[model samples]
Target: MKSGIFCLSLDTELMWGRPDLPIWRQRAATVRPNIQKLLKLFTKYNFPATWAIVGQLFLPGDPLWHGPDIIKAIRKTPRQEIGCHTFNHLDFGRCPIQEADEDLKKWLQATQKQEIKPGSFAFPFNHVGHLKLLAKHGFKAYRGPAGHWFAPLGKAGEIIDSLAQITPPAGKPKQANHGLFNFSESQFYVSAWGLRKYIPLSSRVGKAKKGIRRAIAEKRLFHLWFHPINLSDQTGPLLAGLEEIIKFAKQQPGLEINNMEEMTRQLN
Candidate 1:
């Protein structure tokens, strides 16, 4: 078995990721700087990351949006794997599978025009359920909801998985019924952001360190995920904590650090 795997995925949906939340509109302008910060961090660690971008972000000009420029920068960023986060950030669990499938296809066509055929898909809000459609539409892996941190609270597992930083068991990564790999996310870098600044940087860093240690011991994947918007404010401390985890991962022997596509290929 590999020593461990370190996978970082960024859900790069500006306002579309959380359209229901009116507050997100205020943070829409912060998206570019936040993305730049993440890219800088990736460069510092010589790390590769999967950027699951909303297809609409590729379009030019919309309510203080710099879509084309951001897309160009992401494409230029080294070791960055561009992935799709649906055309309109559709919540697969809430919307009919047929509707979601249509959105997924449109996303592919849009990104394909930009020469990006993403091998990985991360459902908007992590409301994932349409696994068969993902495979049929040609995604190698989809980031699944992590196992329950607390009791299985219905669909709460999906939300908690996106917010909570938890360690996973030592086992092979599971594959979805449709034959796509389920790279279940293990942690959220920024637990809470902006007005709801509940989770401190120290706490997040501590949890990340523990997760890293656990992955090393268990020989499992330490998958960390988050949205760029979360880092729009208080970025210094958050990036510092992330750097701590990345630095620690570098010291381990035979540890496999991979993006979503690479991880899927290796596991398959």
Candidate 2:
């Protein structure tokens, strides 16, 4: 059997993702530092990650919103793939097709300035749509919605799954419209903020380990994703738990870690 693929993707959006939220505004300062820490952790574990950055953040000016420097850092890092999280963080599900197309065009325009033609896309809020536009723009793969049956139930289901420590489902990538692959998410590394702080770190690590084992057994993909800002609250424990998950994954036989780009190539 082929080895299982372990893919980690970070939605590297800062305030762009939650500009309407007061808490996000308050926590804005911590995003950069937490991202730096995450980069170091990935380096320590020799793990490659896909960073799906918000395209608007790549524009010039506005230190609080723009992040050209962060983009440069990810590009300079070895084995890291820089992907797109849409321009303006537009929700494709609710937006008109033309609007979605415009956003993708804008995202391509922004990233092209940096000589980056992103092949992997992560939908804003994981609300997927407009695959034809993505493939038209040359995106080969996208991080799709979670595969869990309980996912559609939204927040309550998510909290229940986290508290129950359910083994996250691992599955094979499915080909979508216009030559794109849907790399469905296996688990979200829940953030230690608000009511989520009550969930123990052990549950997160254990669930990831379980997902890895399931992937190896099923010969499927285990794609884990999280926003960088999620780590800003209680950063220490979250980072430590992430490191533990990475270390555990490293020790597992028949499991190969990859960024989204690598996985897409293998699929092709």
Best-matching candidate per lDDT: 2
Candidate 1 local lDDT, 1-268, one digit each (tens)? 4677778899888888667788788777788877787778788778889988888888876844337677787778787888878888788879988898789888887777878775998888788877788888888887877754553664355344334655543334777578888777777675356433655666677666667677777888778888888776676777787888788788877577888888877777
lDDT of 2 by residue, 135-202 (tens): 88889999887657676887778888988889888878877678898888999999888888888999
Of the candidates shown, which would achieve the greatest TM-score relative to the real structure? 2
Cα displacement (Å) at residue 216, model 1: 1.7
Q: Give one clash count per candidate, in the order shown.
A: 0, 0
Cα lDDT for residue 59, model 2?
A: 86
Q: Model 2: which residue pairs collide?
A: none
